[model samples]
Target: MEEQLQATPICGRHRALNALMAPFGGWDMPIQYEGIIAEHSWCRSSSALFDICHMGEFIFQGDFVADGLEDVFTFSVQTIPLGRSRYGFLLNERGGIVDDLIVFRLAEDKVMIVVNAATAPKDFAVIKERLTGGSFTDITAATGKLDLQGPLSRYVMVEVFGEEVATLPYFRFITLNILGVEAIVSRTGYTGELGYEIFIPADKVGELWDLLLEDERVKPAGLGARDVLRLEVGYSLYGSDIDEETTPLEAGLEGFVNFETTFVGKEALLRQKEQGPPRQKVAFEVNGRRSPRHFYDICSGGENVGMVTSGVFSPMVGKGIGIGFVLPELAVVGTPLTICHERITMEATVCELPFFKDGSVRG
Candidate 1:
C-alpha cells in the first residue's frame, strides 16, 4: 500500500507561488518554484531562500562521557567548542552508515543533533537506544529551518538579521531573536557558498521567508537547485551517494571517521582498513551535455565494473558529472569509463571529487 504523503506548514504558500511539489522522504515537498535553472542561477549570482523545516532536530542534555554520547559517533564530541558544529556519521554494527549528522555543541552538557528528514524516526530510535543517561528530546515539529545561500547571502543576512550573523565563521552559529522567537543562525550550508541556516519557530517561518524575499537580492529556491549546488561541491546525498550498506571508507569519507575512539563498528572498520575497501568511490565527468542518472552501469574494458549512484548535468560546467563506486583499479584519476542506461550511453573520464572548483563557501 502507498502511504499518504504529509505536507509541511508552508505547503499552502508554496502552492500559491505555483511551485512544483513532489513526494520526497514521505512528504509533499517543493522541488522548484519558477524553474530549477532560474533558481540555480539566482543562487550562484545572488541569494536564494530554501525551506528546510523538514529536517530533524534533537536536543541532548547530560554528561557527554557518562551518557554514552561520546562513544556514539565516529568523532569525539567533547573536542568541539561551544557554538561550533561537527559533521560525522552514525554507523551500524557492521561499519555501515546508518546516517550522517551534524552535532552542534551548544554548551558543555548540551548538544543539538541535526539529521536528514527521512531518517528522523529511525535515527531518533537508534540514538536514544545507544544513550544510557542523556535526556534526549526531538524538536522537529517545534522548529522550522530556512537556508539562505549564495555569494550575496551575507549582505542580505546582515541587513535583516544582524551584523552579528554576518560575522559568524564557518561551522559556527549564534542564538538570535527573530520574529519574537529564539533562532539559531549558523554560518554553514549545503550549497558551496557563503550562506546561513536559520532555525526558527515553526509558525514564524512564513514571516522570515517573506522578509527575505522583500530584498531584491534574494529569491526563493527549492530543493532542485539545492541538489545541484551540493553536488557541484562534491557533498554526498544520504540515500543516493550512501546508505546502510556503504561504509565511510568505501564512500571516500574516511577523514570523518576517527579510529582512536571506540564506536559500535570500530572493529569492523579496522578489519576492513587492513584488507582495503572492495569497491572505491569515484567521480567522473562526461564528454557531452547528457546526464548520467542513478543506477547507470559503469563499464571499463567492456566489463561492468561499477554503478553510478548520483549524476547530473552541471549547468555551471555545461557538462555531465557523476559519482559512483568502482573497482579500486578503475578508480584512478583520468581513467576512461562509460556510463550506460537502457539506450543511452555516455563517454566519461574519472576525475577529482569536486566537479566545480571555484566557490564562495569560505567567502
Candidate 2:
C-alpha cells in the first residue's frame, strides 16, 4: 500500500492558487503554480517564493567530539564556525551517500542539521546509533521552511524583512524576529540564485508566506520550477542522482569528503580512491529540445553505457540538458552519445557541468 502523503503549512494557499499538485518525497507538494517553464523563467529574472516546509530539521546540542557527532558525516563538524553552515553528506558502510545535508553551527556546542524529508527518519536513526552522548531531537514538526530565490531576491527580502538581511554573506545565517517570533534566515538555497532559506515556527509560516507574496516583485513557484533551476546549475537531486549504492567519487563530489577525518565510510572511500570508481557522472547537452528523462539508456557506439538520472529543457540555455552515470572512458567532454528510451533516441554530447553559468547565486 502507498503511504499517505503529508502536507505543508501553506498547502491551502497552493490549492487556492490552483497549483498543479503532485507527490514529492512523500509530500503532497505543488508541482507548479503557473507552469514549469514560465515559473522557471520568472525565477531566473526576478524572485520566486517556495514552500520548503517539507524538509526536516534536527537540533543537536552537546560536545562535538565527546558526543561522537564529529565523526558522523564526511566533513568535520568542529571546523564550521558559528553563524555559518556547511554542506556535506552522511554515508553508509559501503561509502554510498545516505543523504546530502547542511549543518548550521548555531553555537559552540549547538548545531542544527537540515536534511531531506524522505531520509529524515533513517538519518536520525543512523546518527543516533553513532552518538554516545548528545541532546539530539527532531524539530521538523515545529519548524517551517520557505525559500526566496533569484536575482532580485535580495531586494525583495530587504523590503519585506529589513536591511540587516541585505548584508548577510553566502552560507551565513542569522536569527531574527519575524511574525513576533525568532526565525533563522540563512543565505542558502537549492536554486542557483542569491537567496535565503527562512525557518520560522510552523504556525507562523502561513503568515510569513502571505507577507512575502504580498510584495509585487515576488511570485510563488513550485517544485517543478525549483527542479529546473537546480538542474541548470548542475546540482544533484538526492534520490535520482546519488543514493546508497552511489559514492561521492562516482558522482564527481569528492571535494565534500575529507579523507583526513575518521568517518564510518572513510575506509571504503579510501579503497575506492586507490582502485578508482567504475562509473563516473557526466553532464551532457542534447542536440535539440528533446529532454532526457530518468532511467533512459545512455549509449555510446550503439552499446548501453549508462542511464540518465536527471534532465530538463533549460530556458536559460535554450536546449535540453542532463546528468547521468556513464562508463569512465566515455565520460569525457565532447564525446558524442545517444540517449535512448524505447524507440525514441536523442543525439547528445558529453559536456561540462553547470549548463547555465550566468546565474546570480554568488552575486
lDDT of model 2, residue 40: 90
Please give the CA lDDT of all the candidate structures: 0.92, 0.94
**TM-score of each model, paired residue for residue:** 0.99, 0.99
Winning model by lDDT: 2
- lDDT per residue for candidate 2 within 1-363, as digits (tens), equals 988999998899999999999998889999999999888988899999999999999999999999999999999999999999999999999999999999999999999999999999899999999999989999998999999999999999888779999999999999999789999999999899889999999999999999999988899999999999999999999999999999999999999998888898998899999998999999999999999999999999889999999998988888999999999999899999999999999999999988999889989
| TM-score for candidate 2, residues paired by index | 0.99
Report the C-alpha displacement of residue 296, candidate 1, in angstroms.
Answer: 0.4
Residue range with the least summed lDDT across 10 consecutive positions in model 2: 155-164
lDDT of 1: 0.92
Each prediction's total of clashing residue pairs, residues at least 3 apart in sequence or on different chains, is 0, 0
